[model samples]
Target: MADRELEEIGEDNTLLLVDDEEPFLKRLARAMEKRGFAVETAGSVAAGRAYATARPPAYAVVDLRLEDGSGLEVVETLRETRPDCRVVVLTGYGAIATAVAAVKIGAMDYLSKPADANDVTAALLAPAGDLPPPPENPMSADRVRWEHIQRVYELCDRNVSETARRLNMHRRTLQRILAKRSPR
Candidate 1:
């Protein structure tokens, strides 16, 4: 299946992967290379932008947040340099607003963090105007709720009071939920 996708992508198999997380970035790069991409990796928005401007790739997998700036800038730069680039936005803090913004700015798809190589490959290769197939293991409602709470908590700088207030949840209740492990 991967071989067929690689063949469909043709000889311009260059791919750029941008992420601040070194380990994850390296792992994804290796995975992509094995799947037939000539991969390049950048650990900051500046590097990503520079690479996009200097040598635009056929595909890109970019993390939404970086130490220097948002990955959206890189996406924009790539689009300007090479409008044919197929880009995927990956984020640990997945929110509807950011996802919409990513797509608006020309990302082919938006994926949450911890996304595996197969999922990323599928997104990158999916045909235009076609909906992606549903996940094999979708998150349960409880897990979804827990993930939302965790995202809010991190956005609030891990301040329990602020997170609870923003969520309209009792401080004690929020604290208890935080104390427990995340649901599956």
Candidate 2:
């Protein structure tokens, strides 16, 4: 499927993948390579930016938050170097505002973390202005809520009170939720 999609796109197979998480970055790079992309990877925003400036790839998958700065900067550099680059912004912290900002900055799509190689490839090769097919297994509402809570908890440095305050949830309720296993 991926091979067919790549052939259909008929663009250069050069792809850049940037992520702060080394393991995920490596895994994704390998997966993309198997799917026919000549993958290059960066573990930081500065490196990603430099790579984009040096040689903008036909496609890019960049994590939104990096140790040094936002991955949007890399997208900007890629756009400047090659306006035709198809960039996908990936992040663990998915939010409406960030998604909008990514699109506005030249990203072709936005995906949350844990997205598989197939999904990434689909997004990269989908024709312009076409909506992606629905997920094979969409997260349940409970799982979505749990994910949002966990993201907020981490953002607040795992302070139960702070997370609850930001979420407008009762401290005890938030504690209870945090104590339980995540929903499927």
Candidate 3:
């Protein structure tokens, strides 16, 4: 971060870190704290709502999907409670549709999962419109298709049979595709 940004982000600044993934949330909270934020964490949408309702943080990192519901619900609530607070949506199963919805609902930025503390800080500090440009070498059509299939598979409760049926894919074929890690 620039010295100007460091100066702006005071040691007393508070942040809400929400994600269903326990390890990720804890690790990120620690990292952000080291960078001078006072971090509070929640592992579900319900908990996040309660926390935000009680004390809205100056910044929030919300996972797109939580245990009880979409993190978009938390973002919407935060926006209503404290319009000035900056919120960023983070998701492993990122989709253009969800990203657009997050922004429209008042998220300052949307980031794919595994974003580092530096990235989150930068996004929160920069003017909402001053986002870094989209990647040049974006995912290919086949890669996009693979990602979408994986997301659906998960959404279908990780039921291989149901996912195959929904995609109209041969059960064995679907399993084969899922057996491998996502294509670059």
Ranking by TM-score: 1, 2, 3
lDDT of each: 0.93, 0.90, 0.87
Which candidate do you rate higher for lDDT, 1 or 3? 1
Candidate that would win on lDDT: 1
Which scores higher on TM-score, 1 or 3? 1
Best by TM-score: 1
Model 2 Cα lDDT, one tens digit per residue, 1-184: 4457668557688999999999999999998888889999999999999999998899999999898888999999999999999999998777888999999998989988779998999899888999988888777889889888998998898999999999999999999999999887
Clashing pairs in 3: none
Error of 2 at 30 (Å): 1.1
lDDT (Cα) of model 2: 0.90
- The digit string of per-residue lDDT tens for model 1 on 134-174 reads 88877778987888999899889899999999999999999
The residue-by-residue lDDT of candidate 3 on 19-85, one tens digit each, is: 9999898889998878778899999999999999999999999999887999999998899888988
| Cα-based TM-score, every candidate | 0.91, 0.89, 0.86
